[model samples]
Target: MTFGGTVLPEWKQRDTRPGAHPLRQSGHGQRFGGPCVKGLWRRAVVVGLALTVAACGRGGVDAKRIAAADGAEWLTYGRTYDEQRFSPLAQVNKDTVGKLGVAWWAEFDTDRGQEATPLVADGVLYTTTAWSKVYAFDARTGKQLWKYDPKVPGEAGFNACCDVVNRGVALWKGRLYVGTIDGRLIALDARTGAVAWDVQTTDRTKPYTITGAPRVVKGKVLIGNGGAEYGVRGYVSAYDADSGKLAWRFYTTPNPKGAPDGAASDRVFRDKASATWSDGVWKESGGGGTVWDAITYDPKLDLVFIGVGNGAPWNHKLRSGGKGDNLFLSSIVALRPETGEYVWHYQTTPGESWDYTATQHIMLADLNIGGVERRVVMQAPKNGFFYVLDARTGALISADKYVPVDWAERIDLSTGRPVEAPSARYRDGGISQQASSPLGGHNWQPMAFSPREGLVYVPAMRNRGFYADALGFKFIPGAWNTGLTRAQAGPNTPSPKPATPPLATGELIAWDPVARKARWTLALPAAWTSGVLATEGGLVFHAAGNAFTAYDANDGKALWSYDAGANVIAPATTYAIDGEQYVALMVGVGGAPMGGDQPRRPGRLLVFKLGGTVKPPPYPAAVAMPPLDLAAATPSKGDADRGAALFGQFCGACHRIGGLLPVLPRSPAILDGEGFKAIVLDGALKANGMAPFRRYFDEAGAEDIRAFLLWQAKQPAPAPKPGGASHG
Candidate 1:
């Protein structure tokens, strides 16, 4: 049985965990023992942690300093509160970029998705890797200072909708905050990786995940969760940074009981959002609408923006009885940061049925439209539309398709709704449609905006969707709850091969949010790509497949390129130390590792500078797997067919044939039936993320799944590329 690796039991840990909160450097210019260090000496020493006596104001990366958008420090997740992801540093501009080469690189121990955006402050670069691990590095030389692993129970891996990846961490007064995949929000002392406060944020019994990074607004740390696909209610929460106490929470969906949840969102959910959802599978599946990603804070408006995810059962008819527009699902909502009070919202996909989640990316900007300067909040959600909305009131300023969207012909500006095609819902019948499917016109990859050029760089995609409802669907707790037929479910399925293959292509679009259109587009041979990074130096950086490249932000010109040695799903970030600008990217593969031969590469931090030369360590060669013998017990007539259906429903989400998880055909367990039954049917390997399937299947079912793998092993296919999974 599996024993270690982030899977520790802490179900009873519901209260705030107290720890040391020593004074830290804010870097805002106060003396060594000034007002910043006046009176916190006793508190610092009490917790057995050494305290620093440096410049401290409110003692953290406060609102004013972040608003300055300094060139040296990348304090916040998106560099600043606006989430523009545009670095102001220009030492390595277009004219000097040709000399750009690798300065330093750091490889992570975990070999899953590297989605974290490294946060740099005062010359220290901090980032998180898979399995909710955090690390601190020297920005200039890439020296590792410390690493902390949450040790989230490996069984919690069953709860993750995507791979076990973390977006990064949030920094506060001398502390770094991270949310674990198993629903714990923890704060670590920045100077020394020691626990300050730890709080369990969700019902441990339910399938809830916190893959997204935490954000700090005012004195509270804000975080949301994933697992809408599994059965759980969604909410964005706030905790006191110093004490780790619960401040408030805002549920994205409503309580079916129609009673107040005693939450900050009680009033709005009761009067507005509660009416839209009906009471069937919706109630059973917790009526999904998790705020998995895209939480932005607007200091000017004093509002926190949250992008909400898809409904629990993605099929609208199945979730809400095919009736009212699910008010908050697939929406961008505004909330008062202090009290979690609801302000206003703009739903991107009304009654969303096609997994068109609005929780892609939300960026705040000031745009000039029709001779007026407007403070706008923009998003290019999963449904293929680019939206520009009034930041203060959530008014629809503009909405238009940025990709080929057949689900909706156009957005009705007058009504602020999509003029959806009738056949798009599959209400007439289960049909295949050519559009941007759950692969999304865009997924969770972070986009970047250049205020200097008035453009938002979007890593856009196009795909086809085949939607069909699962007949006689039963609500399974903490399992794949999308109510989709097995054929259309799992990573193995996206769209069938069409006679024409335009949808398979991806692109980088220089999108003009004000014009509601693409200013320029760069088509890519591969549809799966990485997040974008824009710079004031007239450049945009992103990784397509394994090649990381930089392009001119104004006209989309490829200026520099490097072989990242693997797929990079995370966005690139730029920061400067000692007057030199550096671009750092986290590289790995996860989500849905696009099918094909993949090269095995380590999760890495690759940094670049204008005139520095450093080479990353060579990747270990991919090992070839011996062909499966399957000489033990044989399969029955229909065992392979039954196993094919069963694997897609259960195993396919993680154990893709050529992805991150174990490639079962070559796995030793395939040759050991008794061992396979122990691991699959019994709870033998439950600690290693192989959760017991006895709850859903029997020994015979386990054998059937094995039969299906043996059948696959017997088939002829491409030599295992043995590498990347193009995922989150």
Candidate 2:
């Protein structure tokens, strides 16, 4: 069962080894020197860069006038660059943000999973963790100034279909750039984290991981890869921010011997659309369109937007080996941050079979709406709506349902389509359901937008999930639920759940893009997936589960909170160094499939500010766990009648072996025995993509799978008997 790239060689935490190599440039891609040849090769320009320097577009700067509006120093990744996580640094507004505090903190000795976003400048902070490593800290006393790793390739965490985590870093000139869950693109040296150039942005043998964050602009850097669920092919490159090279790519799907924006009127189905997916399911379904997270960057429209993801075995009738509309997948696109071309696209789920993904957060602004300043580009997309568009012609100036959608009962706006909801698709034994499921009522986080509280906060999550087929599934190169086939366990299973008068939790809302509505909406004890920043006095900042808060962006009330004990993962940034204003976040409670009960492994790295005398710093230690072979470990069970006939011949559409099946198991990190012996002997937990039991167990069939998961967590939990019921 350890399927994806297998590597639990005792949780191999760190062994990087590649340091000081620098000094290249000679015969750059040579032709005169033999061994390489591009356009007859060429190389000569040396050194050059410095002019009080400033070139690289894409919302690149303007932290409200170059890091000033209250400055505490949070360089990028939505802090600015039109990513608009907003932050005009209001020295702890909402009336002294309830005396804010905790001034320091920075514990990430690495249990692997932080999904970064720290990057302060001058006072020094930078982020990036879980498999991509990268640190740097010291932003006002958190200390520990250097870390870097890059070791990626313990089979690239089985090309992470999700969660080997990383999302942070990117500075420019003095250097930093990141991208490398094994797709490479390094750089570093922003005053000594070392390794100046690494390259190789894609082709992790075609698996690609790069968990987001890497924008740099002007002199290039960009990035964008994450196997839209282990089925690759979803470009966006652009390098050379100073010797990394490669320069341009684009390609969000379309090319079958044509694509410069293919068209039949909006890229009309583009060349046989993955030839309807059956035979060899496109090299084991390796074409899902993975641009991982938001990439923003408008520098007054030098473009570079990007979002696109989803379009793999999320059953678009089995990867379009049928249906159609597969065009630039869950799209948004835009491009041209210096030749990555493509320039435009909107799509947002066109032949998309429910994993609906516009990769989440994007922001960018200008607004004034009916008064007409225009330029916008908001986004909430996990298909539950909240759009806004018109960022210079992607059109659709409005879209609603900030949450709980029963699969689009309204979104027609003269013809943007959506009417949807016939129980939301997937036939056969009937089980459909749908309403922002696919763990998305907003996926990937980051969603602010304040210009002194005009609104738009959102952290969202109304939750719902159901759908099937993988008929014979297939594609298994580098695995992680690859290609498919794994849905058994059926029996008395009932579990339909989530419908308690529709308040299934998670919020932060806000809205008001020039009076489009909802300016307030609190709720939150769990389910936020991080994001929210706003500032300039009224306040907003955010973080849940392990606490850290601040609100009142004009009445959601509650200004200031603390705790930082767990959960609250990522997105919460502010800045303003000299004149004071620091906020910073990126805390991870677990590799999120959802985070509520907290504590999974060490994981911490908070950073607040607003006086009462700072403090924090001194936690970083818990990263030293490797010695459990216990001479060939032990924990087995091998046959609940052959694991219920191999989970009903192959895992019944998205897991549910619970009181013995009905399904819809939202990754409780695979319910235990050390997460089932690291999902059967660890290929780094199938390279972070899960679903790996080393191709069906074998160390005594994973000790009879720890006695069938201690006879399935000691059974129980399945009572609630009532009308719509069957009591498995």
Candidate 3:
């Protein structure tokens, strides 16, 4: 998620995302119009009339100008400076939220995922699509206003770890700012979509990419890079909003000369550098720290907070000497917004070896803890701990295990350290099973904080994984490995066997931050990925797998539930216009490591509203399969019989012959005959984990396999079984 950063755990070099562009700002120099006047006597008469109207509340100074006293419009990244992902407008209260529906939706004219939250202001919604192209639309009607493409290089896709989606843009003064995937930040004129200024955040030749939205605070535009998975050092920087001049830079990890060279404030990083990181690990691991998450700011405290991502290579022994806190690797940092000076920091995981990054949520709130009122920074790190710390001083008030975790027994409150397990640390050549899995207890989708409910709701998954050592670990181009066993498949490969775990259902937990306890919990049939959103009407909205539901925030009562018919993986948001409220979210099942494995077909975006009758959207167009020549293989009765016998012998472990089924790499429906032939005949199948069928079957034997496959496909879909059967 971070830009210009190295990959985790092992510090192996990685390729960066392309399309991240440079940013700039525009000022209020043009006077469009103002009040008109005549002579003093005439002005006096007009003033008297104005005073009368003002007294009636119709002619007072516009309150829109007053609201700007803090910050104008949610133009940057994730709404406002704090990135709370919460809106102050209460017009769309729970009472009337049932009427929420899509006024209109812009499909963006592309199949790229809609990960970006639209920046709304001045009746226009500004946002970026996949590959970092910016677009503006009339907020009320979803009419296209303007679109700007940064022309990111084509090869940039190779550097992206996930899909080529941009989270959003930042707005300052009258200009729009965005970071491209290919290591540049650009600023555009809000009125015309014209480029004003652009700057390179880093050299793309090093394989860095930018997917995070740039944040704007005061008069500075701030941004971070992502490539920790690609082995790049991470940093956060500020630039003059109007001129794009570099203001200051803060590197996440300590470097040679102790601090950044040639800066007055560099001395602050002295002495503490070596204390936080072990010797030789920095040079070997490349100090992986990518701050891909959005930054939050509190004007009252004059502080900015950012959630830092996990370390590189994801195998800690290779990154550290089994010692050192690794400085700020998996920590939330508090710094002076104006000076970029580090005030204090709380590391979520010290000497983190399990890729459990503390970089998920950054929620700011005022709570009463232990009879004392305190301003706090709250987070549910991937490591499975819920931490509540004093916002001003970084003092740990409470730390609790929020999920099924065995890596650490408890957090020592006095010393702020974890009670580690002997096998928790990864051994270079030994295999170990760790609880809370590499997915952590949670991932980056984001959680919701309801001030009224005094609760935080998170979509949680419980998983377990095993890590085994691999030899000759080095950064290789176009290669991805954590210096660990491939597939987490089993203790061995090639002659591999399936191992099962106690898979559990996903849960929606409503946590009381003040009490530090779960008020209530509800379990789902499958893993949940969407975050929760609470409204003034006392309803909490969330989606998991194929279901989207609303619950009473007071208790975990399900108020309304709907089978959305698709997996809801992205986070959700709400907004209102012209006294009517609306709820918006994107739902689909394809992207990343999980996408290819998920079963849902057809991606979609569904908008729901109460009392409003709207027809469902048409499904995505079906892809056409190319023609296949099966006759070229030449099949005889003997060959067919032999192929079927061979399939039964080698693939029957995971494949079922009837009710009937085919032994295909993917689902039977996703492939045609030709596709199946290529997979069986070419070695590409085995290269990516699917075993090679040609090893034991001849051309004639392959015909028998094809016959069975066709017969399976032509059979009617199976009836719903009363009891679910497990398949490995």
Candidate 4:
């Protein structure tokens, strides 16, 4: 039989034929056409066949298909190249949303954060879990089809600045590409969950990791790494989809040694970026500009844009002797996807000392500006500013503060830089409090754009940080490289006694980009809320605290909500199966800022549709920590200062004075040396997601930690300040 000019061998004839067509044969088949065709004919036929296969393999997510997604499927990370994350599906509209309930829920093994946005195509749902694990399920029924675990090393968890979380995976050509936390990019056979090819994208020895999802453009899988806090240079690399060979790499920062690294970024760095640096100490610590998140591809313009991270040793004074714009540190750069050539860049935070990363979310759209329709790229970066730029020419169209900010009064449209406040730099050895902490006005939580409403939905944060220089800055081998001390940044300190505290708050703001004003704002109980998803149903979905709530997209009126029983930090996605629309999101909260004191429950993927009848499990009750009697107990007699250092190194990552996990100072077990030894050395809490530190701590070391906890328990808590820093 002939199908689309390609011969399909008959079953009976295949057994009798001596040399059957390679496509019909078993065991490692040859390229589509058989050896029967030769020379020019073979080449032409193969090219044609390849194009056909490519079109089919795109599986409802090709450029044309995504542009016209029509709400039946979610093909790409943002549902389209524009990354608007808005769905046209209205099956569960405002009137019917009140009837929405859980359609199905799938629990994951790891309890770490689940920050992925699932991709639905051809009735299959694809998502990633903690530690870069991928899973596929039936979109309608929620039956697990297959699961793939890259088995990333347990120790690699330390390299991740946040918890061991993976944002998502990319689907292309019948394959799913995922970047493991240990810096490896693996492509899997989408149907069988089998490994297709694996390539290490970063140096295993360095503190580099890949928590962000991969994006595919022009038959190339592009991936970037994280670890700016751990002191590593950052770059984004593209690999051939079929062969897993390196195609090109674009480094975000320049070589520290005043020499070219012979990379795609060399020419641009030397010509445009080198002058922005003062050299010296920055060369030792690779200038941190990790492109951990936010890669968008514009097929119409044929350009790929990446949001670059903050600088290493966050204090610009320490990192670069308090000078230079530090080109590309906090910027959005456009590049040629095929050859990785530089196009143009707009630095969001020049001399980014406050950890104001430009790597938040990038959305593309055509908006009427000054009565003229302009192609624009929009972003609300960490510095608390909403910016609109010419997507084609990289020109600043307009920018305004989307949230409260003191670091800079406003963005200067003429120079494309911020008009810094007098005390914003904090270079005189005095503490400077600034709005929009290191966590940013927005973090990795994605924002959504609605062309129908002409508004951008932002998960806006109101937070601040106190920045003070660490007098004698020293780089730790594999620890956080911020030149500011932990306590000075304001939240990662140990407190023994209780104190009244000012709270940080978050809000969902619908802002008109052209007008630079918010249409409406819905205040959340807590700061650091989840991302937003707007639907044609006249409803917007967002996860705050323990509920997934739907609000009227235009008026911000509460429409409906479901208790997810777990804190959610990932964005919600919508798709349709068999003419029915379903809204899906991952539920788990364990990132840096939301870690301590926040609930630590099992991760779950919850799906909902109108009139669905599945009920979610009840939320776990808060665990009350037992009272401590450290004064009545025998002292461990260890060096309290040494113990304090150890606690900061080991326990500070997850534990806080009043967080989701038990507060160390108030825990009775830590007050008792033997009890501490049992939990830390005997792995008593290993089953509950705590790692056994037996390999790193001995009996004496455990007692030292106990001593520190005892000392901390006796001290008075510092006065809580509003808008204090909280890592995300």
Computed on alpha carbons, the lDDT of every model, listed in order, comes to 0.78, 0.61, 0.60, 0.78
Segments of candidate 4 deviating more than 4 angstroms: 1-61, 488-503, 590-600, 629-634, 642-651, 658-663, 666-706, 716-728
Ranking by TM-score: 1, 4, 3, 2
Per-residue lDDT of model 4, residues 286-387, tens digit only: 888999999999888999999999999788998888899998899999999998999999999999898899888899998988999898899999899899
| Per-prediction TM-score | 0.88, 0.30, 0.74, 0.86
Prediction 2 TM-score vs. true = 0.30
What is the C-alpha lDDT profile of model 2 across 1-728, one tens digit per residue? 12135442211111122321011111122111211112321221101111011122122333232322123345678766777776544446665566667677767765445767887766678888777888887776778788888877565565565546788878865777888777887888877889978988776566677888888777788888877665566777777787887766766665433334332222333344444334324335555777778888776776777888787656665565546666577878776677665656777667677678897788888888877798888888888788888876687777788887886687777666678777676644335657666667777877777766678888777766655554555555444442233333323333333343222457888988667667788878776446677766667777766676787777888766876655665777765443345677777645223211122455777676666355554333334223233224344435544554344333332233221111322233334446555665664354434445566545555544344433453455343222110100
Candidate 3: worst-modelled 10 consecutive residues by lDDT: 19-28
Question: Model 3, stretches more than 4 Å misplaced?
Answer: 1-82, 88-97, 256-260, 263-265, 279-281, 488-505, 525-528, 561-566, 589-611, 621-728
Q: What lDDT score is found at residue 639 in candidate 3? A: 35
For candidate 1, lDDT tens digit of each residue in 105-129?
Answer: 9888777788899998766899999
Q: How many residue pairs clash in each candidate?
A: 13, 58, 55, 6
What lDDT is reached at residue 64 by model 2? 33
